[model samples]
Target: MPAVTVANPLALPRVPEPNPLTGTERPVVSVTTAPKGFEGEGFPVRRAFAGVDLRALDPFVHMDQMGEVEYAPGEPKGTPWHPHRGFETVTYMIDGEMAHSDSHGGGGLIGGGDTQWMTAGSGILHIETPPEHLVASGGLFHGIQLWVNLPRARKFAVPRYQDITSDRVALLSSADGGALVRVIAGEVGGHAGPGSTYTPITLVHATLAPGATLTLPWRPDFNALVYALGGAGTAGAERRPLRAGQLAVYGPGGALTVAADPKQDSRTTALDVFILGGEPIREPVAMYGPFVMNSRTELAQAFEDYQAGRLGSIPAAHAEVRAATPDAD
Candidate 1:
C-alpha cells in the first residue's frame, strides 16, 4: 500500500457574540415563503414552512421549510423532477411520509424521523412527492430542506446520497430533564451522527420541557442558526418566545444556553427546536435556479450538458455517480 497520511481536522472558526435583539433590534432578514415556479405549483403547504434566504449565510445559498402540514383527500402534494448541480440538499422529516425519486435511480419513501442527504455534484435530476396517506389523511408533514454549497474542488465530484433513519441517528439526553439532543450530523457531547457530510457541520434536533434549560458548547469558527419548530423558548440572555416557522440566527460565542418557559405547566406546551451550526464556507457562490456552481461559466456548461443528456445515465436506482468525464464534471 502507498504511504497514508491523515489530513488535519479543519480548524474551527471563532464567532462573535450576538447583539441582543430586543423589540427594537431589527431582524437581519425576515423569513418568507418560497415562490412557485412557472409550473404554477411548488411544494404543497397545508401548513407553510417559513424559508430564509441564504444571502446572509453566504455560500449556504437556500433553505426551504417543508414542515408539518395537513392535506385533504385527493389533494396533490409533490415536487416535480428538478435538476441541481454544485450543491447538496439535506431533508429532515419530522412527520408524515414523503417519497423521493431521482434520475440517479434512487427512490424511497421517508417516513417520520427520517433524513436524506443528497450531494448534487456535477448534475442530477430528482423529485420529492408526497405519499398517498399524507394526501388522504391530511396529517402533519413536518420537515426542512437545507441547501449547502460545494467547494470549488468538489463541485463536480459526482452525485451521492446518504439515507439515515430516525433510529440510526444519535440521541443524547440530559440527566435533569433539561434537554434532549438529537445528533443529525457532526458531534455533540462526544456523540457523532452517522450522516455523510463533505463539510464540517453540527446538526442537532432538540426539545426542552417547561422551565427546563440546556446549555450547548460552541465553536467560534462555525456559523449557527436555530429554527423553532413549535412552542416557545429563549436562547442566551435574550428571552424570546419562538413559534413554528420562525428562525433565530445566533452570533458566535463559546456556549449557547436555552430555556423553556416555566410558566406553562403542560408538558405538551414544551418547545421543539432544531439547532444547526456549521463551519462557514466563506466563499463566493453562483446560483441559477436549482444549480449552484462556483462561476457562471461552469454553471452554463452544466446546463448545456444536462440539456444534451450527457448527465442522464441512470446506472442504478438510487445509484451514486462515482466518476464522470472532465466535460461532465
Candidate 2:
C-alpha cells in the first residue's frame, strides 16, 4: 500500500475542478471481480481484465494484480525467460523488489513505487524474478503488470526500455485534500508523469481517506476503468459499488468520480484505486500466449522468427549465472 505517501496531502498541487456546466460525469458500465490465478512460476495473481471485453480495454491487452500476499523466505517466484512481440509490458512495483533482465541489454531492480516499462515492439526475450536478498529474507509483494497493445504501424518499432522511479511520478491532491494521486504515465488534470507511451493513455494510483471523493477531468475520447486495490469505494456518478479485487468499467463522459467509504477495515485504512484509460485502437486483434498481432499470419511469423532466434539471445553472463543457481529451472 505504500507505493507512495506523504505526511500532508494538502501540500501538493490540487487538481482543478471540472466546470460543472460543461462536464459530463461518466456512468459505470459494469463491475466485475477479478478471478485469482497463478502466473509466472506459480506466483498468485488476480486477472484484472478477466471477463472484460477487449473493446472496452482497447490498447490494453491484459492486466494482472500480482500478489498482495506475504512470501515466506525462499517462496518467491517469477517468470522464466520468455519472448514477447507487438506489445509493451509495464511492471509497476508497489512493494518488494523485482529484478529484470532482457536479451536486449535492458535490466534493473524495481521496488516500492518503481516501474519498468519494456516495449517488445518487434520482439524481445526477458525474465523477471525477486532479487536474491528479497528471496532470502521474505517480504510483502504487491504489484501490477499491464500489457499494452501496439498499433500496426508501431508493431515493429525498435525495442526500448524505461525505468521510472517513484520520485519521477507526478503527485497531486484533491481540492479537499482528502486524496493523494500518483500519475505514473500520461496526464491527469494537466500534470504529466514521466513514462512515455506509444498510445495515448493515463495511469493513476489514488488513495482516498475515508468518506473522501475525487473527481478528475478526463478525455472524452478515451475509455475509462477504475480498479480497487484495497478497501472499498464507489465509482462514477451512478455510484457503482467497488471493493478490493473489483474493476469498474466506465462509459463515455468528460469526468470520472471515485469516493471512499466512511469506514474501512483496520488492515487497510484508506481506499486505494488504480485508474487507467486509453484511446481505442479499433483494429482486429489476434493475440496468443506472448505475441499480440493484428492477424494470425503475423502471429505465426512471430513464432517462426522466435524459433530462429531473431528476437534476442540471452546474455552469456546471465545465462551462466542462472544455470549455476539452484532454482534456474
Candidate 3:
C-alpha cells in the first residue's frame, strides 16, 4: 500500500499495437486487489494469483516473491531440504545472494539477476538458503520462486538443472524506448529467453518508464496475464487503474497494452510487471505438500520414496545447508 523501500529497486527495480496481429484478440484487463499474495510469517507468496481463480494461471501453481525487505544482520533465511516430484522449480534472483543444493548431486550460487531452473522430475531433496556470508552479514533479500507444472508425461522425467546468469538472459527495450523486458523463457523482441521449460511458455520481467506503453503478442491459445510487482499503472482497454500488488488477467490472447506512465493524475510513476503463461496443460491436477502429480497413486509413491531413502538427503557433512546447484557444478 505504501512505497516499498528496498535496498535496490531493480536497477535495483516491450512493443506496439496494430491490426491483424494474426489469430489473436486484444487482451482485456480487469484489476483485482483483495489479495495478490499470502503473507508468509517471513516471505510473501501468491499460490494462485491471490484472489484470482486458479484457471487463470493454469500451469503455474505457486509463485513466491521473497522479501525485498532489509534483514537485520544475521537474519536472512530461506528454504531448507525438501522433496518435490512431478514438477519444476524456477528461482530468479533480484538482489543479494543464495546457495542451492539438491539430492541429485547438483549445486550452485546465484545473485543479482541470476536464475536457477530445476526439474524435480521423479523426486529430489534440496535446500535453498542464503549463502552463509549473507546470513551472517545480513542484507536485503529479494527473489521469486515459481512452480511450473510438468505435464503427466514428463512428471517422472529425469531431474536436471539449468543455471542462467544475468548476461545470458535476453534483456530488450521496446521500440519506443520507454520499457525494458528481461525475458527468461520463450522469446522477446525476436530474441529467445535463456531458461528452458518442459512446458512451452514465455516468462518476462518488464519495467516501464512512466507513460511508456508495450503492446506484445502471444499465441491465441495461451493464457496471458500480468502482475504489478511494484508501483502502479493501467492495463488493457478498460484502462483499469491498478494499484501496487494487483493482478491483471487478460482475455483470450492478442496484443496486450500496458501503460506504466499513469495518466497525469495517478499513483505510481514506474510500473513493474511479471508476465507469463502458455498453452494450458489441460489435465487433472493432484497435489500434496510439495509434490504435484496427476493422480493420488503417484503422490503416494513420492512419500514412500522419501521415507524409504529413495530421494537423497542433504549431506550431513556440510554445515551450510545447500544442494547440488546448476551453476556450482
Choose the strongest candidate by lDDT. Answer: 2
- What lDDT would each prediction earn against the true structure? 0.64, 0.90, 0.72
For residue 90, give model 2's deviation from the true position in Å. 0.7
Alpha-carbon runs more than 4 Å astray in model 3: 1-19, 23-25, 34-41, 44-48, 263-269, 319-329
lDDT (C-alpha) at residue 217 in model 1:
62
Error of 1 at 128 (Å): 0.9
lDDT leaderboard ranking = 2, 3, 1
All-Cα superposition RMSD per candidate: 9.8, 2.8, 5.6
| Prediction 1 TM-score vs. true | 0.77
Report residue 73 deviation for candidate 1 (angstroms): 1.7
The residue-level lDDT of candidate 1 at 150 comes to 79
Model 1, position 291, has a per-residue lDDT of 77
- Give lDDT tens digits, candidate 3, residues 202-291: 888877777877777666677887877677778886677865567778898556767775443243457878788777898888877788
Task: Give one digit per residue, the lDDT tens place, for model 1 in 98-156.
Answer: 88887768888877778899998887877677876667767666676777787888888
Taking all chains together, each candidate's TM-score versus the true structure is 0.77, 0.96, 0.85
lDDT of 2 by residue, 1-329 (tens): 67689999999999888767656999999999999999878899999999999999998989999989899999998888888899899999998999988998888899899989999999888889899998999999999999999999999999999999999999999999999999999998789999899999999999999999999998998999999989998998778899999999999888999999999999999999999999989998999888999999998998898878898888986785331111121
Best of the candidates, TM-score: 2
